[model samples]
Target: MSNNKRVRLSISQKIDLLDQNATGQLNQTDLGEWAMKKFNLDQPLAQQTISNILKNAETLYSNVNVVKNSKSLKTTRYPQLDDEVEKFVADMNNSNLPVNRDSILRYVRHIAQVKCRIPGKEISFSSGWLTKLFKRIGVRSRPMHGESASVDISSENIQNELRKIEELLEPYDPVDIMNFDETGLYYQQPPRRTICSESLGGLKKSKTRLTVGLLCNSDGSYKGHPVVIGQHKSPKCFKTRANLLSMTAIGKKHEVVYHYSTNAWMTNEIFTAYVKKLDVAFGRQNRRIALLLDNASVHKIKIPLNNIKLIFLPANTTSKLQALDAGIIANFKAHFRAQQYDRALCLYISKKLDNLDVYKMDQAQAMFFLANAWLKVNPETIKNCWQHTKILAFKEKTICDFEPVEYPTSALPLEEEIVAELNGMIPDLPGNFNNEVTDVSQLNLEADESDMIVCYTANTTNNEETAEG
Candidate 1:
């Protein structure tokens, strides 16, 4: 049998061929010869492929229907398989797993062999069948990446915890209710893709990063200045440059505060200083202010401060319960990336004319980008994120009610677009960049002490009155 001569036949043609061979009007050899001539095959069909089709002729005929007085062919094989495949896809989606042709084929074989009691050798899950199944099911496979797993959002315990937070917020206004979370940004890391020569298989990207703490109120009424933490206490980049202080001033204008740690980790002491600043800025001396935070070790405060309450979300539930995770952080990242792209474009143009290396991003540039990105995040986005987690419900009592809106889909340009803008400046641009900016905030869940308490005291003097959770 010549593999190259094989021709794909329509369902009606297959059914007619089966009937002709079954009735003995044409023997198998004669039918094969006739099929070769009729289909003008370049090579003969594989015997196994042909035999499988012949053996399943009746099953195919029964499963498919031919339109009356027409040559239209339609298949209705294994209707239940569609439902089973859909459920399998749904399961994969919920677990944040990737689904592809190979995975689907494996699943189908499993169903046939184990669930349907069919022998593994008897199951015929061809690539063609898989393709048709995808079309029938209206699903297209796309590249996907895995995310950190946490507690199930719909679990009873998580729901109850969220409800408790909602009730706890009833006494305070939106401005008094704030959510604080921290995430790491690889400021100087090249995008997952970079323009490089083909000789370089993959560009070595930078690991230079900074941890940023974001604070925003539930009502979207106020967004506190971002607290940026870097590795060095006073980086030479800022200390040596005469104009670097001016760049820091740009961040300050956008309400971006700077801090530093030995390892760039948000420590309890740093968090305390941040909270004290928050108290002073928000004027929490007399009013009760609620600060919602995820269960992170760095967020733990040994002693409580005045008039500020620290509420920790349920363990392993930040992905679902944290307002920052809902969408605010994502928007902030998008804006930051957009700024990076703009900088790259400017460099590309400059490098073309002046022959200067424009790929390296400095700390000052990174801070400027970060500050502007935070400012770009609109109040609507903050409010929507809080509402999304059901932590704060928007009231419709007033004529102008806060309507939850998503971050605009077109707010950030596609990576492809950015690359195109820099076309010809760099050779062999990567098809895709590693761009997996790890949301370190979600991945690092280890607590320094399990019994650590975060207390909100009435004032700096009244440290004795701490609310223990």
Candidate 2:
């Protein structure tokens, strides 16, 4: 009977309380008067509030009735398969005697594809195909994580940087250590793509979704514009490879800089040409590069491959502990989302929502819109977004999920290679979130800045709590 209590109420409990009190004998006037006395409500406010509440009670009741009706309306009747379809089912049943998930999906997808091809699209299997398949066949597929990328990270190079930074940090200020990395931005990349197993889903493509990679700094600054790659009709090997290699350069003119050549920054000529470009981007200085690298095998080709002094981040840590992730990538993803939405809207206005058509709308115009929006964003804004974005936590008793990662075993001068888990101390979160954080950053990367330090974490499995489809 008492509404006044220190405890919080669950949604259902609050609704039940409203029903119990509102449906009781008191009229609105009495209800307001009673509330004022019983619940310590202000006199005038109570009267107006209770008046509005009473008027809306019928609408709330209507909502409850609608929910109840929908829940109770249940029917299960298998629509008889056509004679031809029936024969197929009979053959499968007679041959196998048991239905499997893969077979079910194969059959269903084949049927759905055929039906979809028919014009007017009148042929629908069921609105419940997703739910039905999930229930009957079940989705065991999941998004890829850290180890899916082979680690060519040169531990020797990293150890060398660690030795140098450990000496530097032991005496100097940590803020001076600059940590930087490159991350992909999904512009046309279906920020919301349907995922399936890499092997079985011959139906799925890797670079199918458009993606752009960015070179990022530890303090949350980017050197140049993110490579604005678009989606391919179907994913191409070299195109995906090229797009990933993309990252804006930094140096005095042209000098070997970061650890690995990206989809963007690779040297077409000898390594010195790239170094000369880096020199132009970053003036020659005593700055050591703190690198957070994927353990891809090809990374071992450094020194012989090029000439940038470097430090390597610990294995399996970029997304977990990298300040860029904490500061930039997480925020960038959110900012990029809104950016994409606005960009999409703008392109739609011109009756050209296609990626390529919109791309031609003037690099100046595109930069103008993004710069206007970007000016409003900053590191704090992005860091705050990182606080809310869902991350898949690792769930290991020991470290079984951690595989033996290879360092630089050995490598030729010019081979190319390209780019985890937890849980239960706390409930796992959805591995990703499109938080409404709109903050853009003002930080800029100074090539003359000191050697940067970066850290990140990766696990074998990500929990489903924060998992998004």
| Ten residues in sequence with the least summed lDDT for candidate 1 | 451-460
Which tens-of-lDDT digit does each residue in 1-469 have in candidate 1?
Answer: 6336446776666676677777877656677776667666665544565676798877777756443223334544566677788789989888877778898888888887677676666546888878767776667877542133545767888788877876776677777888899999988665675566675555466778888899888777777777888888767767656375565533346646778888787998999888877667556446678999988888888775677888899888777677898889999999998888777778787675332334457776777788889889999998888888765653333225657678765434447655455543333322112322222222222443332222112232243344331
lDDT of 2 by residue, 1-469 (tens): 9454333322233244367475777766665565546545445224455555556556555544222213222222322223224445467655644445456546655654564343324434554553443432223334443331333334576456445545533332222234334444323333344356663322222242222333433334433333333332223432444432222112222111232233423232323343344434444543434334434343333333222334444566454444555555545556645765676668878886665344233222322333333334574654443333222111121246677887775543332321011212112332122322222111122323232221101211323333553
Give the Cα lDDT of each candidate: 0.71, 0.39
The most accurate candidate by TM-score is: 1
Count of backbone collisions in candidate 1: 11
RMSD of each: 27.9, 25.3
List candidate 2 stretches off by more than 4 Å: 1-172, 184-218, 221-291, 295-309, 325-327, 352-377, 381-469
* Clashing residue pair totals per candidate (backbone < 3 A): 11, 73
Best candidate per lDDT, number?
A: 1
